[model samples]
Target: MTKTDLRHRDVAEAAASQPMLQQVERWSAINSGSANLAGLATMAGLLADAFSALPGELALLDGAPSERVSASGQVLETLHGRHLRLRVRPDASRRMLFTGHMDTVYPADHSFQSISPIMDGRLNGPGVADMKGGLAVLLAALSAIERSGAAGSIGYDVLINSDEEVGSPSSAALLADLAPTKIAALTYEPALPDGTLAGARGGSGNFSILVRGRSAHAGRNPADGRNAVVAAADLTLRLAGVASPGLSVNPAKIDGGGPNNVVPDTAVLRVNFRPAGEEDVRHARTAVEAAAASVARDHDVAVEVHGGFGRPPKPVDPAAEKLFALVRECGRMIDLDVRWRSTGGVCDGNNIAACGVPVVDTMGVRGGAIHSPDEYLIVESLAERAMLSALAICRIADGGLA
Candidate 1:
């Protein structure tokens, strides 16, 4: 290896020994579930403190107004907790974006709150592999880069949002606002169980269709009442028929049914759709709107649809492929084999890619059972992936990824 390669390996090895798990343990102890505003605030503060060691102007940004339809058929605006931002050398010749989510899928009352060793070299917890571990790796990698005296060569913005678990409805604008300035992005989503990465990702959308109808007593004047529950059921089944080769539709739940003595006047259909590409996105939207209109007309109920596809499909284009190649090279330098495959899951990477920036998102620790109570992190990968990311950043700073 050359002198510079030897220097990178030394930095990687040094970063590998950092106290990554200590931070992961501390972070996983907090319950920063998507809907838990207070918990998210706590996590944000903790993250701000941890990330303050980096050189940058760090600030907390308010979340956008995210709309949702409540069970009462009333549209409500929900605000997410503050998201942390760190901007360094905004005018540098090369700019990069790094992102991670502070929220997990577990609620505040969830029973799985602490980390414990589950196997010979793995620890399981609520957010261990889903992303808290990833955040630890990100900090270690950036710290290594700074220590190696290459921090000034690149400009980067790190965004830690708190609502990715529920689909980043509030932080989507933040990702977009910083996308145009970035040539590439690295999102610290957990790597797959085998340490493989995700390349292209399918687009996802969550929707709630509210159906309004007249309520009447079940035993009397029932014929005069338009049952919104039945209308919602019909719409749900119709939505299933909209599924095809490139699109999957899931009608998750139907809310708003009351006592059996009365005809239900209001119902809401909660649906999720995944599109394989841009055309599928348009097709799915058109089909959903048309089906809602048809069901409303047939059942004599007024239907109001809320929510749209927030994440667009992410394709590994030429630019993204180049970055992947650089990461693979970095992995080889560290004696780690790196590979990637397409995934159906979506994240902030989709939004970043939509702005014409290349992103390699799953650069975190390796483990299995993400977003579950059994979520785990491989102890060895905590250091291994941190070294990988630090080397990647160093390579980028040296004009290798550019």
Candidate 2:
């Protein structure tokens, strides 16, 4: 009846009829955990084919070799990973980045790879919510934009990184390179169950502390041995408090030490942290390094804390605030109520934003149970998200309200 009404009708027509759900199901069924290098390669190939088939400019960046060198000089050259980039329209000065990861937390051995049939209108799978569903939604929304004949109005670049689950060790450079040139970015990492978006995200870092201590006979000279496990335990306790104003420190895993007999000579502490700002991240790192050194000195052990902030914080800058406000307005235009919240949960978006691009991190459809068998996407939001993203793309490329 009216312009707004007609627009809504157009959005509905554009989104309601795609094989997008099938795409989601297929992707979710393939466990692409970064640890499963083989599976990730397969998924990357699949994504390449999908992108190649799209009626747009697409490029499959050559795989890069990322090596993990052990203390023993053993070099573990990880699988050569591929990243896909697809561009719609062209405006180099006013660019946008749409980021998502093709990798999930499920490994090749995980039993959560099955995509159950529609139950209560929800499809369940390993990555249905975590992100495979989001990828499908990306494709569907792009297709809808294509059909809307507004494709040329939205100049966007879609980047699907293959190694997000493992801290994105290899793809960070690409994200950085793309971020500096983009005006805004939308990361399809699913919204909350209530359909609220992720406002600002904390920066993330992964660290591992290896302690080396002298081992001695348990019964004969237990006192003569320096216990690396003890040093690690102390360090962990201290590292637990690294969370300050905008930082959170978490010692997730610790390993080493055989039986209770001989004094333990080795310990490995694996910890992860997230910061809300650059200073927060630096403070957390300082605290971690200080704690490690103190513990090692006190326990007569050699300790090493090696790692850096992998993804910098996507602070609540004016640009990001503008993005959220725009998306909210976009929701209003589509008759959907949308909200957002800041969180410590990091994603590829954080990595993207670190490159200085403003980004709305939760552009995916509302969903829950990410990384679990119970994962599901809210089917009702499929069209809502697609329309919102497409509309936003159009506005941004049109040089307004991005």
Candidate 3:
């Protein structure tokens, strides 16, 4: 076993000796969806209270950034809330930001709100992997960093946003604001079942295309009516892999239709594109616009596409690679052969990377099936990650790990 490996293991053990699991269970009990106004407020309050209990500078990021919340298949409502960004110390230069989202895919009234024991080693719960457990790890890791005589070494910041599950529409600006000054960032997103994590992510854009057309009787005067669904279908077919350059075009839903007797006057096509690179994003956006224009022109209907790229892809930056190497070295120092990889899943890391900050995601506890009721976090990796975080912070803080 390497020295860094042994040190990481010891630090992990030390962190585990604290009330880590208890804290995880505590946070896991809450359902904080981005759109759940009351729940989000409660969670923000809980986090503020928890951080206040600790010895750091804690405050609500009221001015950080926020937005109106919207749900799937529903009109948007005006709801204002912000992510919590805290800095333990302000004097150090080489800094790191640790980010986690309090939001989950599950709604406030979902039936699977209750956590259940699935097996000997797994506890299935909403947001357990998609990341309430990861938040627990973040808090615990920061706590250990403070307690392990390494507090304030690297001038770290922790940003816990409330809207990562819905593509981080509201929190992206806040993340970018916090990113420019930091040397690196560590995001608390759950690792895969085997503890692998994102090395590359596709930039995602969610679009709603609304088509306006004239309605008429289908059987009696089909030619007089414009079938918006048909037009939308045409648009969908055309948009599917239009550029095919590391971009995926997926048409998820068709809305605003009528019964069998009448031609649909309006159609809304929910289209989302994931681009493998930033250039792919630009190309995809142009293609979507062209496809929308072509459809509108051919069908003599007006179409509007709403929404843009929320977060860009976190390509394997050299700094990110360095941070990952440091984590791997820390793992070796602790005697654990860490398993990790890159992926196309988007997270708060995307927002951080958009800020031009180097980052290593999957710094949260190891887990699987995030954003699902079958979500589970590993019982062991909590401490491992905490330890790795501590060492990374210490090494980076103490003069370039030399």
Against the true structure, whose TM-score is highest? Answer: 1
Stretches of candidate 2 above 4 Å error?
1-12, 55-57, 62-77, 88-91, 147-149
lDDT ranking from best candidate downward: 1, 2, 3
In model 2, where is the ten-residue run with the lowest total lDDT?
Answer: 67-76
Question: Residue 279 deviation, candidate 2, in Å?
Answer: 2.3
Model 3 Cα lDDT, one tens digit per residue, 130-187:
7777777777766765666655556877788887888777767777777898888888
What is the Cα-based lDDT of residue 295 in candidate 1? 90
Query: In candidate 1, which residue ranges exceed 4 Å CA deviation?
Result: none
Residue 121, candidate 2: how far off, in angstroms?
Answer: 2.2
In the range 1-402, model 2's lDDT, one tens digit per residue, is 557446545754575566667777777667788777677777877887766645668876755667553543233677646778887666645767888888888777877768877878677777787787678777776777666665554466788988877777777787777677777888898999888888778888887778889899889999999988888889888988666767778888777788788898888788888787888877987797788778877898888766678888877788888877777876777788888888878888887776777888788878898866788888777767777877676666556653
Per-candidate TM equals 0.97, 0.90, 0.90
Model 2, residue 55: C-alpha shift (Å): 4.3
Q: Rank the candidates by TM-score, best first.
A: 1, 3, 2
Which 10-residue span in candidate 3 carries the lowest summed lDDT? 66-75
Best by lDDT: 1
